[model samples]
Target: MSASDIRAEARRVLGICDACGYCNGFCDLFEAARRRSALTDADLAHLANLCHACRNCFQACQYAPPHVFAVNVPRTLARMRHQSYLDHVWPQTFAPLLNHPVATVIGVTLGAILLLFALVLAFAPAGGGLAIETGATAGAFYRVLPWTLMVGLGVLPLGWSALAIGLGWRRYWGLTRPRRATTGEARRRWCAWRTTLADILNLRNLRGGGVGCNDLDARFSPWRRWLHQTLLGGLGLSFAATLAATFYHHGLGLQAPYPLLSPPVLLGTLGGIALMIASLGLGWLEWRTAPEPIASESRRLDQAFLGLLLAVAGSGLALLLWRATPAMASLLVVHLGTVLAFFMLLPYSKFVHAGYRAIALRCESLDPVSID
Candidate 1:
């Protein structure tokens, strides 16, 4: 759909929703909408990102579907949210990949893995990089993949993803008037910042105000919130593990393949398990629940992202478990390749949602009524 069409539909839904305050306490989207007289571009973008697609409002709405109002807030806001991703994505030229992202992600990831595998095979050391056991040691991994190439693979893709995400976030923030223009404005924005940050960290709206979200059916449950927390916590821990490893390697001059009792190994092992479980759980939850309003395209994008996360976690664990065997060499390549793929796709995938949502929350916090 075109941008203008999305904006029009969003405005129509917002107008109807504004008149009926039944869903005012369901989520941040509704609460923010309640404070607005009409929907502007900024208002729509903020409201769209605030939505978590829990489908609570749809289940609770009296004027839903069969009625004339036909107010499907979740579905409407989801499409608008997708549009925002496309609009704010950096490089602008690659934004079309958001249309059906699974193909692009799969193709790019496989190609990178294959290319890395070929390079490893072609440039093996005199004893050979593959088909030989490196044994368990501090610098065993480098015997398979050179430390320079491995580090380059790790750093370059992450740097690119960070830059792209930063650019996209800046653009989105501009749409929402992200900065304070005056002294009072600065204080108000600061207040909003605190409110928004607290709400995001706790995922306050995921609880459907007080009750839980309408996750599986009309009945409310906190399973979705719990699962989301698991996912975020796992991801955060995994990132911390990487940082710890980086510090060990650079600051302390430690080498590869730390022992199981070490901080990096323990953190990564637990994180991998968490990520794997959360990815699987989220996929199951999406399958079991009713996503009537969430578009097929958006669901596909979500699946693609979950697929990448699973690949990263699965391969990481596999490598860790069998690092001393001949299989370690190939496993290292697969693991690093998947990591590279994850970073390269980060800006265009569901990962971008975090940045967009953070900006939206910042905008919402600026409203005086949004406090607490």
Candidate 2:
């Protein structure tokens, strides 16, 4: 069935599971679901984002497939999570990203890189090839491609990504209909918020309720959790590196090509290492994961995003190692290309999972669980 059918199908499945209350402790999704009398489209969407696809409930369920209930929380929620991207994407025309998956990302990234190289060749001074070295000093990157051109190309897509995520968040938060709380309820919710924050940070749900998640089968493993955290840590560190570089340029009057011990170099080195490790590890996990419980359609998308991340991290690290040599010029172009592509696709890709899941966790925090 098409993605549009997700809401209806999920409603049916969740309706049955909610009544049974058999899988209440499987993860936060079931716990959140238990508090509600009826699951609406918005509620299901929020709940779907909260799911980590640990597959505990799917394995534990007695009414799966052959039974009339046919409750598959992981599969149904995965589809709904994907549909959220389609429904909330910016510029509407670009929403087709959900259809093309991996090919589009790879093609766009490569094309952008080639176009940039062409531009560099066309605009460089006579007898200079991308890199220009003055008498005793190192060849600074800006001499190859000026800051104006770099920022001009980057700002547009980055701005659009920020706008799209902001709008998508507004749409998602509006749908959840978080209630206004009294002081007593607010206090309890504040405590719940602390708990939810910890869960999100640690990905407690992927721990298979404690032992670990079922990656390929009923067997539990924490490898997926560690790999994902590594990716998260890498992304954060890379951003910090960029921010440090920006401050060095604008605030401190220092320029590009800082020392190895400097903030930018140190942060970028650590971040790049983490990113490479996580991207490769996650790509391997995706390759080995079975198609049964997990959503099959997301496989290509996941791989494409991970591929771009790997390219970015690898190229950045290479640029660092070869900065003193002639190779830095080409490495810079490759890194910029991959990074631009990643920022452009962030809103439409699986990258949005972090933001959407955070919103879902906040909503679940405010929700009160009733006891008999």
Best model number under TM-score = 1
lDDT of 1 by residue, 28-147 (tens): 776677776557777788788888877888898888887898888888889999989998999899898888789978987898899778878876565647765764677777777778
How would you encode candidate 2's per-residue C-alpha lDDT over 1-372 as one tens digit per residue? 675578888888888887888888768887777666566667777888889888888888898766787778888888888887777776678878866768778888998898778867876555444665431133367666667777877888899889987887787777774755445666787887897789788998888778888877777889889988999999899899989988998899887788899998899999999999999998988888766667766676688888888988998888888777777678778878888888888887778778788888877776644211
All candidates' TM-scores?
0.94, 0.91
Evaluate all candidate structures by whole-model CA lDDT and list the values in order: 0.82, 0.79
Name the lDDT of candidate 1: 0.82
- Residue 199 accuracy (lDDT) in model 2: 78
Mark the 10 consecutive residues where model 1 has the least summed lDDT.
Answer: 363-372
Error of 2 at 339 (Å): 0.9
- Report the lDDT of model 2 for residue 95: 79
Q: Which residue runs of candidate 2 sit more than 4 Å off their true CA positions?
A: 65-69, 125-139, 180-192, 369-372
List candidate 1 stretches off by more than 4 Å. 178-190, 368-372
Model 2 lDDT, full chain set:
0.79
